[model samples]
Target: MQFLLDSADRQRLSLDARPDGALTLVFDEATGEQASVAPRTLLWYKLACTLPAKLPPAIVRDYATKTFKPAQAYGALLNTLGPCR
Candidate 1:
């Protein structure tokens, strides 16, 4: 999936999901910077973008109910981490 990271210049960031269950983040062009993002963070960011309020309620419900397995698993993992400080 590709996301626009910068709106002014239309800089894009891509998330490539490999067949072996790995994810790679790619930039549209060389930016001469180093960056790292956790998988869960990326997942939430994607959800935030795709499930915006401007979308129809039915679409949002379908995405949250049918396509939210990753978020659900992340939630379960967070539960095992105990309460936040």
Candidate 2:
């Protein structure tokens, strides 16, 4: 349920942060093991960071909450320096 972590349903989109503090939403519906809609991928590359803020007005902007991949969810997963996933 953690950010960027594999999900059972795979519906839980996992987003992470980039080097410049931006975020990269990586959620490939197709595991390459089967077919799926938007199978090619539906990535949101380099989204702006929004940490210390709760519940982003836009659902796509929210940070890791309970189990959701927050916009700035890679704050810790990055060795405290890597991308915010």
Among the numbered candidates, top TM-score falls to: 1
Report the CA-based lDDT of candidate 2 relative to the real structure: 0.39
Query: Candidate 1 on 1-85: residue-level lDDT in tens?
Result: 2223333457566544433434445654576332333444654455334432343456445656554654444444333322322
After superposing candidate 1 on the true structure, give the runs of residues whose Cα lies further than 4 Å from its correct spot.
1-9, 31-37, 42-85
Scored against the true structure, residue 45 in model 1 reaches a CA lDDT of: 52
Top candidate by lDDT? 1
lDDT of 2 by residue, 1-85 (tens): 1344334565555544344444444466365232221212332112222233334457545433676664444334333332334
Global lDDT of each model? Answer: 0.43, 0.39
TM-score of structure candidate 1:
0.30
